[model samples]
Target: MTPIVRDFRPDDAEAVAAVRRAALPFMVTTPEGIAFEVDQASPAARYRLLVAEEDGEVTGTARVGLAHQSPTPGQAFVNAYVHPGHRGRGAGSLIVTTAEAYLAGEGAAQVYSWVLDEPHFRTFAERRGYRPSRPAHFLRLDLSNGELPPLEEPPAGYELRAAADFADDPRPLFEAEAECTADEPSDIAAELDDYEDWLADTWSHPDLDRDLTMVAVADGKVVAFSAARTDGHTRYASGMTGTLRTHRGRGLARLVKNHSLHRARAAGCTEAFTGNDADNGPMLAVNKWFGYDICATEVRHVRELG
Candidate 1:
């Protein structure tokens, strides 16, 4: 059956999530999360969720959008995934072609995609005119059976709190996140200056597990955090974990992430996942200390539009 590409509909949320789970099990994806992304996307993002249907079944999906918050312009991204069972069909190709055309029409000058480091996936991206850029690793932790580092009490003048603790006023958390994000290593730099957008896109996200998202406070201000996202079932993922520059080397990152993992396990989560840039030795070492094993690697690929 020939594959056909089309815009995502509300009812396609479940199928899209299913495809994502099948293609990348390390990441948490849910129907509610999918719906939230489509419904809450800012107009500046020019976001489009494309689905490739074959014989009336969603075989592949692509998330196409501009890097609206990036300091640079004309930057866009397309993450296309096909169910393992559906590979070699035209689904992936159709989805990528459609995504590129849409991004081009939206005035994108360059497009980026993350291709799994496996041979076939790399070949697919190269054939589509993408060149290798940065690499990252996906790590997995066995929350149910693996022994998590014992939780430790915060040092004097510092306290640990759940993200929910900031429900009334999350600006403190946002400030910390923006500071940490600015220091993160990325090919496309993003500046989180819009507090309202952060509230809508991050604080109110459906998958954000506030109870499991741990925050570290010093002098009554947020200094570090481990943002968590859960599937509302057995899967949990670290959306972002970082510490303010001045607070680094104080073990805050480990403190917050370990605390979150322990709480997530107690809350019945069986699996935990996170991604780290290949060159980020500190974070990679941190995850290693938490007994996370590298499960998969992805290489960022970029193509410049003429």
Candidate 2:
């Protein structure tokens, strides 16, 4: 039977997460996180999660939407992945076609995707008119076996805390996240001007491990943070690790992340993973210091959808 592509249902969350795990094992996601993403997306995002089914079995999934945080207009993305065993079944093509059509209808003039850095993957994207742009690396650490850096006390006047400490008022953390995000290297500049949106899309995310997310406070201000996400099983991932501009030279980024890693290991996490843009040298160096090895690479591909 020919594969049929349709909007993802609440029941499809687990299957979609399964497909995501099979396609990109280094990235951590949960079934509830999948549903949260769809439900919390802003209307301007035009988010749609689509699934491709064959014989009543889900074989692929796609997430397509406008880049709502990007200040640039007409920027969008469609990332589609087919399970390794389900490749060559035309599901990828059908999902991409539907995703592009949806983005175009939302007034997107350009769509970007991340293609696995392999010969066939590159060829497939090029065949569909997507041209390669920036490259990124997926790094992995064996939290179960590898020795994590021992936790150390923060510098004078700096205290280590978890995100949970800010449960009553997280505006300070939100402000820090926005400032650090704006300074991070990226193809599309992100603007986090909406505090309420950030609260819905990130702070309250089901996958965010508030206890494992470490922060560095100096002068009672959120200066550095290591955002952590877990699958509630064995996998732990760094959602983002950054320090305020004024705190960069103080090694606060390393301090918070190291503390968080120790917390994760103590909590029984067996694996850790993170992604880095090729040009982000500082963060890459930090990951390397933690003994993370490059497990895979993906090249950003952009297509003008005039």
Candidate 3:
């Protein structure tokens, strides 16, 4: 078994997506999305998707890059995944080593990754000098058969609309996203205040389903939104769901999310996934009301740089 790591090619999309699905079923990945990332990765991220080939067969992958989107300099992330059947071999460790070298070359001082809660996975990271930090949970909802809260009309003067309605101008959506993200509970806070950068990264992302993303508007002002990302097949994921600080207790987040999930179900998505920090009590409560169950837990681990 000769396993070698190499940079990803356009043809590796399907195989890459397959490996990700088997290793982490919680996140939805598509061939197009994989390709798009490789083509559009920011220069600062130094993003490279590496595949581990065992005797000409792609078995594992590593998404290695700087957290360029993050305001913190020298912060990098390496998410490595090896297929179940391919585990126990050196594929996973090799990918990690390869990614770390690349990030180090790219000027990443401190590396971070989300190690699965499983004993072996956690042990692997700890042995590599990475200490655990914040923890996040991955949740799933069976939209096909599970019960979902019925969608309701927003209060008078407040209405629900699809994100596509703002096709002509999405600056308002960016404004809302920036505000909500700044308020999120996270170990590494994100500041996404630039619209052009947001356009290049978020709104124009391959998986963003504008028609399915629900937004709550009050008096023509975009106040709350639930962005939906889908695989165009059977899986749906809530990319982000948030409400502006001005309208927190108005049930707007619930309203937009419920509508987005319903639309996803109608569009043939059977499984839905969302994640949250353990400290985000408000979001955990919201997800529970929507009938989502905890599927997997990932404890965020961080390591200091020399």
Candidate 4:
């Protein structure tokens, strides 16, 4: 079967979402979410949503882009997914070839990607000259029947609020994100310098569940938060949980996450999912405290683009 690769169309959202869901079940995805990503992606990143089709059916998809948020220059990322039934058909290779060509043209020195922790998949990345760096695990919690830890009253001078409560003004949340990002462990450091861009891509994403995203406020300032993303079905994920540098070590991160999980459970979410680098001991401890179990693992791989 001959496969043709082309830019994605708005109507192709379902096929693209299907590809992502089938290839990566641990992550939450939706058609509307796909459209939102392509629509709001910053131009600096040069984001491209590509799909590989055989005859008239979409079988593979790739999200290729530069890391615009990263302070490091010329860093690129490409995450591709192919339907399980369509393996060994050259679709994956074609998508990677297309992504690398684009990234290389943009003067990217290195490209980062995540490959599942499987023998056959690792062999493929090694064959393509990619080296493993950091490993991350995806955790899942069965929330349907399990008894969640009871929410506690906020400590003095601290109040718990939903992310939606700040709709009128989210600059405080942005400030918290900026501070927390400074501590995240990543090869490329990110700087969240623009609030307008965050509004478009992060705050306004189709799947972001603001009502379930818990925020910690101190003296009317957003000091910590646990963002939530839902599939509008039964699955929920911790988008990002961060505490301002000054607020760290106060248990605010864990506090907001617990509040968010309870909100999600009350909102009919049956399962919770989150991912963290194996080296992030603090977050790993927090997730373990929440009763989340590691369900899947992936290793970040890097390769120099020719």
lDDT string for model 2 (1-306, tens) is 799999999999999999999999989989999999999998889999999999999999999999989999999999999999999989999999999998998999999999999998999999999999999999999998898887789999999999999999999989999999999887788999999999999999999999999999999999999999999989999999999998898888889999999999999999999999999999999999899999999999999997
Query: Considering TM-score, which of the candidate structures 3 and 4 is the better prediction for this target?
Result: 4
**Steric clash pairs (candidate 2):** none
Q: Pairing residues by index, what is the TM-score of model 2?
A: 0.99
Better of 1 and 4 by TM-score: 1
Each model's TM-score?
0.99, 0.99, 0.97, 0.98
Off by over 4 Å in 1: none
lDDT of 1: 0.95
Off by over 4 Å in 2: none
lDDT of all predictions = 0.95, 0.94, 0.90, 0.91
* Predictions: Cα RMSD each: 0.7, 0.7, 1.2, 0.9
Off by over 4 Å in 3: none
Q: Roughly what TM-score does model 3 have, to 2 decimal places?
A: 0.97
Question: Which lDDT value does model 2 have at 164?
Answer: 98
lDDT of 3 by residue, 1-306 (tens): 968999999999999999999999999999999999888777767899999999888999989888876788899988899998899889988998888888888888888898899999999999989899988999999988997898798988898899999999999999999999988987666788667878888888999999999999988899999999999888999999999998999888899999999999999999999999999999999999998999999998887666
Tens-digit lDDT track for model 4 on 1-306? 878889999999999999999999999899999999999999999999999999899999999999999988989998889999998899988999999999999989999999999997788888888999899999999899877777888788999999899999988888888888878888768999999999998999989998999999999899989999999989998899988877789998889999999888888999999999888999999999889999999999999977
Looking at model 1, residue 217 earns an lDDT score of: 96
Evaluated against the true structure, the overall lDDT of model 2 is 0.94
